[model samples]
Target: MSAEIAPQPLLQVNNIEVVYDHVILVLKGVSLQVNHGSIVALLGANGAGKSTTLKAISNLLRAERGDVTKGSITFEGRQIGKSDAPQLVRRGIIQVMEGRRCFEHLSVEEDLMTGAYTRRDGRAAIKQDLEMVFNYFPRLTTRKSTKTGYISGGEQQMVAIGRALMARPKLMLLDEPSMGLAPQLVEEIFQIIVRLNREENVSILLAEQNVNRALKVADFAYILENGRVVLDGDAETIRKNEDVREFYLGLTEIGKKSYRDVKHYRRRKRWLA
Candidate 1:
């Protein structure tokens, strides 16, 4: 019998470096992979270059005067280095950026419709997808006709995710989906994300600060510090790691200590050494 060949990655980022305004380097030789139909979490603190990495993949860095000056990013065997944001969207790659940016003036439904602007598939399919989004996010159904600005922060986040779903993405680069929301709302949103990955087969590259929650949902995880991937492994392994438990998950043999305190208390982590 022939050996079964493993499937190629849905998205591959190889040794990429990002710089802002051609001067300030943000990501230093960062690299990772997202296999087809898998959820990969990128966990890190604020300003750890997680968002920058996502922007590079979705080709949205240009708007912020940032550029991928080294290495490459490819989606399904095609290089996307020079692709524009809209062009990437048309190719089934969409990014739900940090801050849950919404068309504040538009109704919830209208905000979602904007996500399908790249599609030429006509209104029937679009309408069907919109209903599917509502199914995943029942709360969105209640606020469909309400202006997005009028909704709560959690609802706006749902609108953002629903809008991305309307794009029917093959790969979704989600940056900080749990930011500034109540714990219950965060859990609700992540449940939907898991459903999207398992049932819809949409591959996800999630950048998150909530380590405990991210690991619970992710198949694989990468930990970043100061723009570099410090450690990476399967979710189970990462969850059990001492450094991860102490630094990210707020667990310690002695007692719970802040990450800043831990950083200064120890000489340096083995990964950094």
Candidate 2:
């Protein structure tokens, strides 16, 4: 008889619930998993418990008067809810939060170095890692000495991502990396994430409101509505689904056209008049 093999999950959240001040319940029973070297997208509307899930995993839910009332979050086959943020970082699970919360007063290089605080490795190794981060984000290297507050929003976002990379994470929890950025910048950031997953083999658990673009890049996807996973499947399948198209992606049968078409139509109407 062949030995039965157990499927290994890099991170797992089974029936987790979080509440704020014992009054407002945020996450009802959210659950998902990320395997090795795969991108999983958690898609939903605003306040749909996407960020809440990331916070729950990182033990940062406390700041918002929140606590996980039920269930467990395991990372690398070990339960981690009791571990502090620094401990979690040491375990190689890092989160680039919703806001690109770099220290405004600090230089860009200094902000990235903060992620390496948990490391006790030799200075040469640290320097090498720093160089690697810069290689991935050369724009940051050019402005390494500048205060983070003065950089563009997109650059600050890069600093946030680079800082997380400095931790040498086995898994990355990214919350809304494309938010509030221009269309060009959003594309740039998504490309960087795709490269990170493909080139570096970094397992990513991405919680994003930009459903269309996320589904395009993710290997697998989970749709969270009202704190429950209403849909789960391969990314391409979900992208083609009618329900997903209407609710999340907002893609209509007419198809998406560039903004230039609308302007051209307006000009034609004025000329006809």
Candidate 3:
């Protein structure tokens, strides 16, 4: 019988440490991997280094005066230490940032077109992808001519994701796609994200604080605390973990407990132990 080759991870972050402005040590030996055609969620609290991890992967740290002080980041087996954001984008890794950033003055369609700026594949191809984006986010079709800033928050979020879709990314770094939106809108955005993953075959590295919500859509998950990955497993296993239930998901053995009831309960630091 012939031997089968193992597939390399689509993205790899190996024991990386991040420092901001040469002083603030943020990510301490943090490491993760996103396999081909899988949705991997990076779960944590606000300061747990989720966004920093995304920025690290996308090479956006330099603009913020941050640096990867240790370890390595590789995309498809090539070390990306010196690769810039534009280069990464050209290579099909796109980051939809946390704040749903878009050009306020640009119409929704115009904002989306910018995502295709790096492509040399010609206008006809770009327009085809734009239509693909609209198909996934049908709400965008109705607001395509409106200035992005004038749209509802949910629509603006749709615009942000739609713009990233226009890039035709192979891997998407989604930072908190559910932030600052209604419950319904959050669900809607996540549904579109899953659709993108399944239909487009785009691998995703999702950074989110919404443990319950992120786990629902994630195929695999890593939980971070104070800049290190504390626990990791398939999404379903992580969901049923007792410590994760009590700490992150706000559930306990009996039932849901108020912060007042569980305030004094010591959260076990499995990483430290």
Q: What is the TM-score of each candidate against the true structure?
A: 0.94, 0.89, 0.94
Candidate 3 lDDT over 1-273, as tens digits, reads: 001222788899999999999999999998888888889999999898999999999999999999999999999999997899999999989999998987899999999999998999999999999999888888889898999999988898888888888888999999998889999999999998899899998999999989999999998899988889989988999999998898888777987767765655534464352
Q: For residues 1-273, could you state the per-residue lDDT of candidate 1 as single tens digits?
A: 001233678889999999999999999999998888888999988898899999999988999999999999888989989889999999999999999999999999999999999999989999999999889988888888999999999999999998998999999999999999999999999999999998998999999999999999998999988888888998889999998888788787878777677867544663453
Off by over 4 Å in 2: 1-6, 253-273
Each prediction's RMSD to truth: 2.9, 8.6, 3.0
Clashing pairs in 3: none
Q: Which ten contiguous residues of candidate 2 have the minimum total lDDT?
A: 1-10
Task: Pick out the ten consecutive residues of candidate 3 with the lowest summed lDDT.
Answer: 1-10
Query: Each model's C-alpha lDDT?
Result: 0.90, 0.86, 0.89
Alpha-carbon shift of residue 233 in model 3 (angstroms):
0.6
Candidates sorted by lDDT, best first: 1, 3, 2
